[model samples]
Target: MFLLMSSNSHHWNLMAVASSSASPQEKYDVFLSFRGADTRNTFTSHLYAALCQKKINAFIDDEELKRGEQISPSLLNAIEQSKISLIIFSEGYASSRWCLEELEKILECKNSYGQIVIPVFYGVYPSDVRNQTGTFGKVFDELEKDRQEMLQRWRTALREAANLSGFDSDVIK
Candidate 1:
């Protein structure tokens, strides 16, 4: 049986919930998806540290994927293996193609394996993500027209993730 968190009255019983059908092959409890340039030194770092303090095995690709135009296989595997995916939508998240690829894979896993996906709007509005407005839409404008199909996939993933129940850092702080 694999341990999972179950919510009760906004409280999570981290150790109490178990899933017998959950994959034993899962190496991580959560897969973190974020733009390093935006949150590597600030929010993402502290969030990762806090998860570590709680003994939550979370995956954050800081050094492993420093120089890649495409999302690496190992990073995709990390997303597939995790029970939950936490997407931190910052100012530049939609600017990176690599980040968009990761987001697509996370949503795919959510559909196929029943993986949980949570979006954290960090200094960004959910409407902006869903509608691809502001910086999010500006990045799409800069992309080549030849990659229209891929662009559409990324947009759908962003919209879907933005619609989920999640924390808005702006509201919390």
Candidate 2:
């Protein structure tokens, strides 16, 4: 990124800020977020494998986290330490409260810490996520029956995340 600075002599000077420069070091280069049951065996596994083959530091949760409970401290720390987050939004993604919680934290890191987030709409559409249409909308309706406040957070997070430019699996081929 280049910045323009105004000088005392009424002339503007250009300053270069390279966005690609590597930082000192981080625990992980990328953190994976997805509905494990949906893509764990197919697209996500392939993605994790490819990232490993290229020697990229990626984090894939080793143990499955159950829903509507205290999240592991380590997972929260992982989100803070990673340089990038890859959120794989599948058909049933919003159904998992745990996934919604993770998405909230990921977006928080994005706003407060500048952690990059890349949303992947796998077997779904970005508009569906942003608008909470289709399965996403259905899930929220269920969540609204009880956890209304938490559900609202999830909806806002999805809307913000889906607003970003990301890859569509259907368009890959």
Instruction: Give per-model TM-scores.
Output: 0.85, 0.83
Best by lDDT: 1
For 60-135, candidate 2 gives per-residue lDDT tens digits of 9877766656768888888877888889999889888878888999999999978889898888889999988988
lDDT of 2 at 30: 83
Candidate 2 weakest lDDT stretch, 10 residues: 1-10
lDDT of 1: 0.82
User: Which regions in candidate 2 have their CA more than 4 angstroms from the true location?
Assistant: 1-25
Per-residue lDDT tens digits for candidate 1, residues 73-135, read: 999999999998989999888888888999999999999988989898988988899999988
Residue 53, candidate 1: Cα error in Å is 0.4
